[model samples]
Target: MSERREHAEPFPDGSHGDLRADCERCFALCCVAPAFAASADFAIDKPAGQACPNLRQDFRCGIHRDLRKRGFSGCTVFDCFGAGQKVSQVTFGGQDWRRAPRTAKQMFEVFAVMRQLHELLWYLSEALTLQPARPLHGELRLALDEIERLTLDSPGALLGLNLAAHRQGVSDLLLRVSELVRAEVRGSKKDRKKDRRGADLIGADLRGADLRGANLRGAYLIGADLRGADLRLADLIGADFRNADLRGADLTGSIFLIQSQLDAAKGDAGTRLPPSLTHPAHWSPGDRKVGPVVGA
Candidate 1:
């Protein structure tokens, strides 16, 4: 498990405080519940329900400070949206899988469901904060309340949920929120028509592009050169930013830009971000000179 900052202030229904990962209150559920294949992100193959060799008995990562060097970088970018602690402390009442061996399988299954629900809460909380999305606040709040209620469901009830259908319903509402927020940007009709939603831009050069109010939802931006790009007010929900160069990019006020997406990208001090997100620790402190833009 990775260390995360604690958010003390509460949001609607007092659910915002626990939207960020808090590994201390968790039971190392992330480390044991998910299966990992040997790849650039992970150094070894790990099976579901089995503890990682690097997981300490205290539920902390053994290579917490050196996960990148240890080839476990994937672990660093993972954000459970505080679902681990919620399941461990609230749903299960602090009952750990180890102490109750019979509950291990069910606990892991519920963790999966709880993680998705918590992620929806994170996005909804952010949506409620956007002034441009004020028109949808009532809808967003109602959705948030419903999801928060679902989070407290018993493990059996959670596992019985049709997560895909539920997620689609929330995603539809979020899409409306994104449109409401992004529409505040005064972009030309031509620019507005340049919808990059789910576009395949892998390794494409996008340096210094004017992408304000662009729709990049679910776009494959892996290794793209986005340095100095203006991404303000862009809809970045589910965007794949793995290794994307975001140095000098202005993403201020970008909608649905989550910390995990930024964690997977390469950025620097010059990369402007929304107030809700912080610079990833892995980002460089200084900018580096690069060649001219390839495909603007």
Candidate 2:
């Protein structure tokens, strides 16, 4: 299945959202602008300005179907958060970097900036949908609008933007939202002191643990055994899920969980997911647990 589902209705009112990647309308900026190192994730080392070896004249990956077999599994997990298309069509006025050599450097620079802004938009959009965060909805909407405005700025203005400062402010707001929502989980006595933002959790045996409303932002959960873990309403914004075992886990109401994160992790068909997320094509089939929202 494609990473982006067309006209995906993610809003509470069942309206369609525009924060999805439409590759057909893009200039394949992600294939050209980002650098990749020679590792298990990528077959070759590519410098920042150089195009990937697998990138074709039409800007499609030469081995898209067999990316994992060819050691390019990293590509499967990477999501530009629709920034590639926004930068290609809006910021650069539909002009391609290869066709317009003079604007190539500037286009790449602006693309990096736009990617960060789009990620912020993704988080802000999700935060607005949470009922418990109603108090901060006005502030969240304002931040989303301000970030959207910055994405429309000229290449020079985008390059000069202090994105780190903006991200810090947004992160703070999201942390507060997490507290408001997770606090309301009935019968959930999960430890509040265990909230670790960006902690190294490699190979953690947290199977069957109750992680409801936990702030696991940026936690390194690579290879963590999380089978049957209750992750309802947890804030997993920037969690590193590579190789994490999520078989039979119920993540129905998890916040800030995205397709890219799922793609990086390991799971089975039985792994319960939110309505907005699709099961990864690589998962094994089994009778997994479904979240509380379903069949309630």
Candidate 3:
């Protein structure tokens, strides 16, 4: 099989672009934290908290040479926001979690927290690109400050975060940002159409949100709880869902989004499977496998 080449368009000239390559610094946390089922992309089943078969002892992909051929397409989409390396080199100071079994659980928890915090940074960085959100720039800057402070917290403090409250705060601000950006992107003349460009929706609890056919082009959705989200026909071009929960999210007709984005978003059995995702048999998460994307 021919190797697929997917070049990432970094957010360009900022912390976002700089953070794009940070995954290598950590423990490959995304691969171990998520679960998966057998599909065209994977040859077996794997579950959360278990190391993927494709993962090597050196913290590299064993099948990097043929990830697609080996049925692990989902692996292609994860972006750790440099948390993997931060947790590995900086947080744990190059100590292997496997060797320090006493701290393994802590390591996992820290990994999870750092991942969320990093995801928030991704959105804040993107929000800078949205020229229309100029009015809210002050507010966005404040929010970014709050999130950045959280990133510097100790592992113990990070694990103890009041994530619910934090999410609520971020969600409210993101909604305002979204509305403002949407107004400019859609313009006053366009009918009451959906417009969600550059919204800082990180960690927004959008469970069962009605976004069907809504225009979410270039929206920053990192770490948003999209459980049971209605993404049907939603124009999701350039939307960033890194670390966002997409369990039960219907993305049937959403255009311009790619499997790489989905790979970063968290999904579970309750998560509605997109046809484009191939379930890998190496996935120990569950027995069920995801079918193919019909349109593609």
Candidate 4:
């Protein structure tokens, strides 16, 4: 007997809404613009604005099979959410660095900007699908509209912007969305953060948790609710924050958290940030002032 019970989608977010893993439309933009250092995540040294040596004429990885052995785990982690292709085809109108040498640098800049905006859109779009966040559905829709507009701008316009403020605004709206969604997930509870050093909290409701100065070393925190949690002065060394909701967590004073963990967390506007991470234009922490957006 075949089990035909009511079936639900195995993947919740619709595979990033069909954007990631679709690099054919892109002209391998990420492989060109972002530089990589020879680390566990990269096989070679690449410059920020230069094309990767491994990028072939057809824009495919040359040593793709041996990527892990060669040390490019970081490259594998980056997903463009179809923004690469959109910028390459729609924004730039099929122009490429190989063909239009004069427009190469400008094209690369547009790709970078569109990638960030599209990433925001992907998350917002996912937020729209969550049932409990209905209270903030209207806000999510508005954010999605704004984010999509930015994503579809002409290449020239995208390159001319310093959207740190724009990101901040969107992040603010996203925080409210997360809170509403959390209500159904956690009920009417403080959901305080706990030290619980070695607890088996596979799917704990840690929203608004006060985990400041806590030690979560080697903790398995996958898919945990870290929204609005105070993680200041916390030690998160070796913690697995993969797919965790850090929408509004404060990690400004957190200790021992390298870039790898931050990159894994799903953070938004309410997330009190560290200088190591990108900041919105409006937030000017103690001594470090944000400089102009672009570089010549």
lDDT, candidates in the order shown: 0.85, 0.81, 0.64, 0.63
- Give lDDT: candidate 3, residue 271: 51
Off by over 4 Å in 2: 1-8, 14-16, 186-190, 286-296
Summed backbone clashes in each candidate are: 0, 1, 36, 4
Checking candidate 4 for backbone clashes, the offending pairs are 41-72, 42-71, 193-209, 193-210
Q: Quote each prediction's TM-score.
A: 0.92, 0.92, 0.63, 0.62
Give the per-residue Cα lDDT of candidate 4 at 191.
42
The digit string of per-residue lDDT tens for model 4 on 157-256 reads 7877778977777767655554554333233234434445555555679999877656575688888988888776455655777667877678764543
TM-score of 3: 0.63
Model 1, 128-217: lDDT tens digits are 877778888999999999999999999999999999998999999999888887775646787777589999999999999888889999
Q: Encode model 3's per-residue lDDT on 1-296: one tens digit a residue.
A: 11223333434353455445454566666667666778754677888778887778877777777775666655665556667777777778888777787777787778878776766666666565456567878887888789878877777888899876876676576556555554533444342445566777888998998776567767889889988887765556568877788776776544445545766567755454444343222222664445334345
Candidate 2 lDDT, 184-233, residue by residue in tens: 66343447655877989899999998887677889999999999998887
